[model samples]
Target chain A: MSTTTLLLLLVLVGVLTYLYRYAMIGLFASRSLPAWLHALCRHIAPASFAALTASGLFVAGGEVVFAFDTPRPWAALAAVLVAWRTRNVLATIGAGMAALYLLKLLFPT
Target chain B: MVQIPTSAGGEFLAGCRDEAPLLLGVAPFGMIYGIAALAAGVPAWVAQLASAIVFAGAAQLVIVQMLAAGAGFIPIALTSGLLNLRHVLYSASMAEYVRHLPRRWRLLLAYVLTDEAYAVAVLRYQQRHAAAADHAEHTDSGTPAADATADLRHWYFLGAGFTLWAGWQLSTAAGLLFGATIPPEWELDFAVPLTFIALLTLLLRERAGQAAALVAGLGALAFAALPYKLGLVAAIVLGLAAGAWAVRRLGPVR
Candidate 1:
């Protein structure tokens, strides 16, 4: 993409994102949320984030690739374990990256 | 709701305080965004500007990747917007808490309505409001009695936001500057998926959450071939449906 097009696209995306965020605050500013809606909103982050993460983990070259031999699943498992045990994001990512690199080194195809 | 008068400086500090723990989670993610943006062929200036202008890590990463893959602008914009749709839910949740504040305060809070800030602020608000309700129930059944309101949560958010904002900008710059130096053989590319896995594990603290995560994971895998990144969107819808269904069937935690 040309610089101008990329810049314009970035600007449009940014404004749209801001609008998405501001839409709720604008609509609900003067009122309390219904209990049911509040309950539903509580699940939004986890569910959306899970989807984003899952797609990134398992998809490769426009296809689903799942197997024990793949480096990603094992690396992700290591990261999940570190995150669960330490509850630290940095350590989890670092460990995951390290594990993947080590696996690639040990079992090159 | 008790109103606490705070100066702009106080409000900014309050924002920082609420965001500290979340900054820990966000910083490395920002670093990953930096690296990925470069690897995806986004120019250095554009990548750095993304953190300042867009300021949403996942969306920025996805957008840059799509741009590199020759995706159309409209699809990129839509995907970015869709990835950030949860922010709307967060904004709505936080609106009631800050509604009575001045317009300026509300506007500032709205601009800084990030996932971490929203989570911490909402949790604090719920805890405080429940305490206030309990106190009022015990002391005077009908009357709205005087209540002690703590505004520390606002400071917490400021701490988190400023910290994250700074980290994002610097990390993106670092990635642009040093990304070429890093060897592809190192397989640092796996960091992206790993980071997500760690984040997902954190969210799976409850049985319902676990079930929702599993459903989303499987759904995304099954629908991975959908064009224009629709698989991610499908996974989100299915995950939300699964969670809502689970909640309806199982009821809330005892």
Candidate 2:
């Protein structure tokens, strides 16, 4: 793509993305969401985060690995245990990273 | 509207603090994005420019990857646009919290909205709302418990957003400069999953919350092959539906 074309694409995406971010806010400005959507909205946080976490741990470079041989799932198990116990984000992440590096050293995968 | 007694500065700082834990995850992602851009032959200056304008990690990375592969201008733009469709949900969920702010402030906030910031901010709102509701019975004493939180939510949003903005820019610069040599030992990308797990553990206080999270996580794994990130959206929708069902079935415990 030419420099001008790249720039144009970038700008177009920015505009359209901004619109996606803004449209719902605009609709929601004047009125409240109905009861069912309200209930669903309440769950959005956990569900989305869960999906992200699972994908992060299980999917390596877009490929899903169900086998226990992968480092991520093993390390993530340690992370889950630490998080469940400590409920501290910093500690959980630190432990998970440390576990990953250690596993990488031992397993060399 | 009754004004909350908390200082704006205090609230902002609190927001920053709450967001601080998540930044560990963010910086690595930003660095990877930066490295990916340079790898795709996007000039350092142009990469930074796109970072500033686009400011979205996944989409910006997709732009570089697609462009490097000789994808046409239209698909590159559309791919990024599709990647951002989930933000519409974030905006809708957040609209009620931020609607009262001035239009300019609202627009700026909307611009800064991202998954990390939105997650922390929404969690904060949930906590504050719960705290306020706890004291609703004490309103006979005329303490405006919830009112203070309304204003604080916006300030927190700003503070979290500013931190993410700075972190992203700095990490991207580092990645551009030293991406190849960052060393695989760091395994920095793992932070993203760790951050989410930590957050989920901290946030899951009820059966409904548990249900939503499990379903979403499993669902995403099951639907991981869906193109255009639709799997993510589908997982989220199903997770939330499960949560709502659990709430209704369980009869809403505090």
Candidate 3:
């Protein structure tokens, strides 16, 4: 792609993406959401983060790899335990990364 | 323990401080993005600019991938848009918290919004809400003092957004300039998922929350093959439905 083309794509997608990010916030700013929508909103964080976490741990190259050879799932398990127990973001990330490196060392694949 | 700030400056600083830990994952991911964008033949400047302008990490990465494959303009735009559709949900969830702000502030926040920033900001907002609820429980009349302090929470959101933005720009540049310094063996990208897992755990205190997360996580895996990242959207929708159903079945928790 030419520089001009790349620049154009950047601006085009940037605007489009911004619209998505701004849509609900901008349009619904004045009006209060109905009760059901409010209830749905409460679950957004959990649902979005959970799906993101699962895909990040399990999916590789567009495929959902369920094999045990990779250290991600175990690392994620460690992170989950730390998060559940400590509720500390720093500790949870530390535990997960430590678990990953250790498992990689112990079981190189 | 760090105190939650009541004033705007304090809240902003608190936002930056709270977000600092996540940078361990984010910085590496940004560098990886820069390196990948370079590898995909994105001009160094354009890659850096895209980091600033698009600001959506996964979608930016997808755009680079599509560019490498010689995809045309419309396809790239549409795919990026589709992948970012999830932001609409984030925007909706956040609308109530940020609605009281001025239009300029709302626009500014919307621009800097990303999954990482949203996660951190939403957590802070929820903490404030929880604290307020607890205060109301104890006091005969709700404290206007607490309400007044909470209104400045957007400053905290701005602080977190700015930190993530600055880190992303610097990391992208670093990746382009010193791509070889970071080893692929370290698998720095894995930290991103770990960050998400940590966040997911924090959000799963209630049974309904847990049910939503479980269904959504499983649903994402099940729908992983869907094109244009629709699987993520589908999983989130399913997860929300699951959460609502659990609430209905179990009755609302006090």
Using DockQ as the measure, the top candidate is 1
Taking all chains together, each candidate's TM-score versus the true structure is 0.76, 0.60, 0.61
lDDT of 1 by residue, A1-109 (tens): 6778889988887777777666656655665556666555556556656766676666776687676787777878888888889987678988888888788889887
Local error of candidate 1 at residue B214 (angstroms): 2.2
Query: What is the lDDT, from 0 to 100, of the residue B86 in candidate 1?
Result: 63
RMSD of 2: 7.3
DockQ of each: 0.54, 0.45, 0.44
| Per-residue lDDT over B64-136 for candidate 1, one digit per residue giving the tens place of the 0 to 100 score | 6556445566657765766676677777766656655556656666666777667766765676667668767
Cα misplacement distance, residue B27 of candidate 3 (Å):
5.7
Candidate 3, residue A24: the lDDT equals 75
Model 3 bad stretches (over 4 Å): A1-17, A20-29, A59-65, B1-47, B56-164, B171-180, B225-229, B252-254
Supply candidate 1's per-residue lDDT for A48.
Answer: 59
Query: Scored by CA lDDT, what does every candidate get?
Result: 0.69, 0.73, 0.78
Interface RMSD of 3: 5.1
Q: Which stretches of candidate 2 lie over 4 Å from their true place?
A: A1-28, A59-64, B1-106, B113-164, B175-178, B224-230
Per-residue lDDT for A14 in model 2?
Answer: 82
Instruction: In model 1, state the lDDT of residue B224.
Output: 76
In Å, residue B149's CA in model 3 sits off its true spot by 20
lDDT tens digits by residue: candidate 3, A58-100: 7665688876767878888888889889987668878988999
